[model samples]
Target: MNVSRRDEDGPRRVVVGVSGSLGSLAALHRAVAEAGRLGAEVLAVLAWEPPGGEFGYRRSPCPPLLAAVRDAAAGRLATALGEAFGGARPAVPLRSLAVRGQTVPVLVGLAGRPDDLLVVGAGRGLLRRGLRPSVAAGCLRQAGCPVLAVPRPALQHDLDALHRRHFWHLPEEPVPAR
Candidate 1:
């Protein structure tokens, strides 16, 4: 016999992973839209790990520094939320959290309800290691709920291209095709 548990977590949630990147902002917007469409609440989650990973922190733990890092993570989450919504509240109910852990696990664990929806950005930037598609992939494999991977906004792609050109000191105007 199968036992089904009731979700005590009020409304279904559109759980989004936010990292303050343009891609993440795009995901956040998509999540809000989904929440509105589904009459669900929006749960914006930002995950952070201590500098140099857990092993590094364990080797030389500093409580004060750890506190500062955690505080910074919370501040970044607040800033990302404001930037994502342009300081205007979303029409849907919204809740924000900044947790200390691996991103994929944190997201998957929080969005464990069968009705929950997990949203993640699909890319990062040209000059960086970029969005770990693995986050979305991991969620897809592990989440009990549906996963929505939002593609990076076109503007982000353009900005990344411009950044790439600037990094290489290339002329802004491309050479005319022969």
Candidate 2:
């Protein structure tokens, strides 16, 4: 993939998936920091499922309430970005989009172009087993550019300590070489 800087003067384009989760917020923060460092623009995306069904026969059009929720979600994402960037006023260029579809397809389509990076949060256990993997893993496999998966930050110090303790453990070692 195209990992190096495309142009010395131009800003890079970063697309971050925001789902209102803690991990998603972490991803957003990471994207903002990276963008700020690279002088890159950020495309904050929020994907929501359509209100209607596959066919239009019996299903109704999108309701106003649902539309409002989507808008609110997008707004929250923008707010989060602003907070994460320390109220820096969106350095390069910040664009927020609310799409009606699955997150994976939307992000993949967004990342298909060059000079773009995809950033997403490592989801909770349930989400990891389902949509999260589809979006994160699928984007990594399909996106023409590089994908960054930012794991959720650990909250407690004990958890970090435990992680450090297990960090040196080897999976293939035998029990005391017995």
Candidate 3:
């Protein structure tokens, strides 16, 4: 853990990963709340990877296709951020980054600074809770600083609100771990 009183550049900030998932959105809100209390900033990262299999088999991509994919990812990030913040930017600064990579490694990389707090959702689905591991679990294992994995109840509440306002669905919010 970084024992430093303050970061070299400035005050330490909260870093969160958002993927338009209920868990991720909840994590974003939690990060924002932490930042507000700490009087810090927020680094919102939306990491994405291209389609695999046939798409990955080829080394080079057509410029137009790659651009289109990146644009779509950016749009998703924007929408997620808007929804997470209730359509208004918070009082704290929120920097959004859309990168091309696996979610865990990308988020872990951003959490390299000892002062940085890595926040992620518990993720979704039966596989995430059971058969498959969650991205939050991966970041917790490798992140340099503290990791906060927001529980599914908070996530479910957020999803429920969104469902009411935007006609969305909360299909797989897990029960809080006992």
Candidate 4:
């Protein structure tokens, strides 16, 4: 599924993954604020595993409870993001999506394009191993564009402080090549 907003003079597009964790929230907020500053659109994604059996042992249908939980979480995430970034007016277009599949593949597929910026949280959790040779790392290695992995706690605090100060700037130059 694709969500696109056509604005002749708007910010670029960014994709943020929210895994219903504090880290994910931080990433979402950061993405929103950054997108706002850059005049970009936001794509908030939540990927959940559907109810099923291992391999092909016994396939179970997605229970209503699981579906409800996922739906509610998605809604809450959207609302929270909207509230966090929402201001006097809708400065940025934030699109929230709930997908059924593995997190890494879903995220990579969502932000694989060259035009999109993939934003993810970094820590120790399902979505934390983005820097390692896991799904997140794989996406970073294979993604057509750049991948921004924000350290959940520290990065979130820094962003909050920066917002309050109302002074921030991107790095002047890229990090020296390894």
TM-score-best of 1 and 3: 1
Clashes of each: 0, 0, 0, 3
lDDT of each: 0.89, 0.73, 0.81, 0.70
Residue 133 shift from truth in candidate 4, angstroms: 7.5
- Whichever of 3 and 4 has more TM-score, that candidate is 3
Assess the local accuracy of residue 175 in candidate 1 as a C-alpha lDDT between 0 and 100.
78
Residue pairs in clash, model 1: none
Predicted structure 4, TM vs. truth: 0.63
Residue-level lDDT for 28 in candidate 2: 82
TM-score of each: 0.86, 0.66, 0.77, 0.63
Best by lDDT: 1
What value of lDDT does candidate 1 attain over all alpha carbons?
A: 0.89
Superior candidate under lDDT, 2 versus 3: 3
Residue 160 lDDT (model 4)? 60
Off by over 4 Å in 4: 1-11, 52-58, 62-66, 69-73, 79-90, 125-135, 155-178
Evaluate model 3: give its TM-score: 0.77
TM-score (C-alpha) between model 1 and the true structure: 0.86
